[model samples]
Target: MRFLRNALLALAACAFAARPAMAQEILRDTESEALLQDMAAPIVKAAGFQPGAIDIVLLNDPSINAFVAGGQAIYIHSGLIETADNANEVQGVIAHEMGHITGGHVIRSSEGMADASRISILSLLLGAVAVAAGSAEAGMGAIMAGQRAALGKFLAFTRVQESSADAAGAKFLSDAGISGRGSIAFFDKLMGEEIRHGISQDDDEQFVRTHPMTGDRMSRLRDVYSKDPAWNTPVDPQLQSRFVLMKAKLEGYLATPEATLRDYPLSRDDEAALYARAYAYHKDARMDQAIAETDALLSREPDNPYFLELKGQVLLESGRPDEALESLRRANELTRNSPLIAAIFGHALIATEDPAHYDEARQVLRAAVARDRDNPFAWYQLGVVYAAQGDEPRARLASAEQQILSREYARALMSARAAESALPKDTPDWLRAQDIRMQAEAELERSRDRR
Candidate 1:
């Protein structure tokens, strides 16, 4: 599991090649990502997007929310996953966010904001004129009224977008042949939370809110969904099973050990419970218990790559790098060298501190990074391999790759320039270094202008 918090501002920055500073930790796990992809594939395809064109990122946050922030990606908070009862609920969420993407809502949001700003400015000007005429009380009232009008206008615009997204989501679910029951159910849960938190549910509250009231959303969705043929379709058992395990795994990773153990006690012997306790034990530094839990999971499904990955991660972090290699290697093979898992496996090979493993680490990491250039961690590991082999120029190039992704433009510029000066002219590595140098310089210039 990779938690990109500080070094990576947002995975979207790398994944989408867009630099939007978001102060949220990104959670990267192979199993969760694979399952999310599987769950979202049909919905995404139904929305006319090609496979793998959209990314679903998990944020290590406790807020029950999902959003599309200027990319063909859905950012789902861990809390939302934890709150969901099944994978279908998440698919419903994904379909809604996809609606925003297809509708160009993120790009169009600026228009709404700009329109509201104009109304406010016009109101302020009229208020100033009234004040100049010696009616200060009337001017104050006008200004307040203008502010309210601007807010109402913006809120109404957003409400329309939300309704559009809701309709689009329902249509996508219908097109994908997935039941909308989960969509209505999830909204029902949101309504329950609103009531539990003492949020006003009256019609007066709807105008001030960005989204339509949960009750209203659910009512409309239920009407449309009940008429759809997929409404009574059964949930995919395998998908639901995976969702349970994923949710449990997330809870164990995010919650305190005490809470994890309390919720998933040792008495529970199910796969989900074992998965949760494995992470819980690992977090608490109970290596023996963690290994035991992982072993139990592997025993149930001997070829399960995720269980092996967990075991390898536990062993590697617990200073058992030599022991981690076999499990990680097998996990990497089973996953067909998934970039994230392969990176971890390469790290394990390097952690052995044996020269014999360095060559393999270099090969594995090089391929991993080649497949996923956005992975700064893989580039860092590859750099270590190059440095170990006394290849300073390539080492610098790798560092440049990592530094650029981490938004260290000045350091990236220096590293890329150093690599470029030393490497053979017009070679692939040289070209890459030059590209990094130019990109870094442009970013730095943009930064200076912004400042």
Candidate 2:
């Protein structure tokens, strides 16, 4: 246990590698991922981590945080997005996290650690939190986050190791055509936050708790950037516009209607700004205003897939089922793979009573499932679609499976035990298979008791 603890800490601090206990099923959808991919393209090529294959999971936490849990995965907090004022900053964060994976930090840590169990448990805690919060699809599995206070109770890294990660990460930024200035700037922001909070380390995020902060480190980062050619590179227009627009849309989604309109208005310079306003009005429940703004944006841009997507969402939310279907179908045709848009279309299909919806829903869901197979929510929805048209046996199985996947622990345990009867005992993936089975059981039990 001690080995695991010390190792994970050292790895996180020294090499920035993560030997995660279990991988979270969190995944990014096609539309939201487009921008992330655009931003990451430079460094991913430089870093040599299967460029398009690497997954970036967006965590739901509002705190300023980011990390690479698995060797190939990058987890960015939704709060990180809200906090980053520009695309460069977000890219810098990703580059730093990616550095950890490239460095083999976790494996290095494990090689030197003492207590394997303690390390594994601590890692499990962090992994679980990230999985629930950062999952791409709506329903993240299980809930243990209320006990975050207990998350870092095991081996954690030294200040020296953290410093190494930062130094290494800065290099990744430079190699990726981004100025390490973003790292410096981000640390600067956090340092300001620390000062504002009186450097209350006790109140810092879980990631910060393990990876402490210092002003000298920030200064060092700035010095590194002084020599980086990317420091002067201008931020791309498309990236900048998307950042603002995404932030605006997310704000509108979470904040109150008045607040939404206040932050994101229609009379902006870019097409994205217009899309943001359209979304704000949609959420504000002003149908006419939303449609008018969207149509105007369409008139200007003529064929923005994102705008079309927003139009679909607005139409659906505002009770225009048929129109929503048309818009979403068009949006899907344009992009060919958007889970959010597909999900919306599924709902719209129900309203349209179109016979084609049954198969398309399955097809869209299949695509969605391909991207995020562990998404019990998508699976559950698929089960419903199957059940709605009278496939009781398939519906029951999917429901049972989904219920298990969603944390029906006891039931999943039973199901796994049942599966065990016919399984080969020596299979290498046996443990992994059983673990998932147990998680499903746990979810089932919890849901039944509602605790």
The residue-by-residue lDDT of candidate 1 on 1-451, one tens digit each, is 0121221223223222233325778898889999999999999999999988899998887877888878788888888999999988999999998898898877776566566667777778888999999999888788778777776776677778789999999999999999999998899888888899999999888887778888889998999999999999988899999999999999889998899999999899999999999999999999999999999999999889999999999999999999999999999999999999999999999999999999999999988997889899999999999999899999999999999999999999999999999999999999999999999999999999998
Q: What RMSD value applies to candidate 2? A: 11.8
Residue-level error in angstroms, candidate 1, position 18? 14
lDDT of each: 0.88, 0.65
Q: Highest TM-score, which number?
A: 1
Which residues of candidate 1, in runs, are more than 4 Å off?
A: 1-21
Q: Which 10 consecutive positions of candidate 1 have the poorest summed lDDT?
A: 1-10
How far residue 438's Cα lies from its native spot in candidate 2, in Å, is: 7.6
Question: lDDT of candidate 1?
Answer: 0.88
Per-candidate TM-score against the hidden true structure:
0.94, 0.72
Best by lDDT: 1
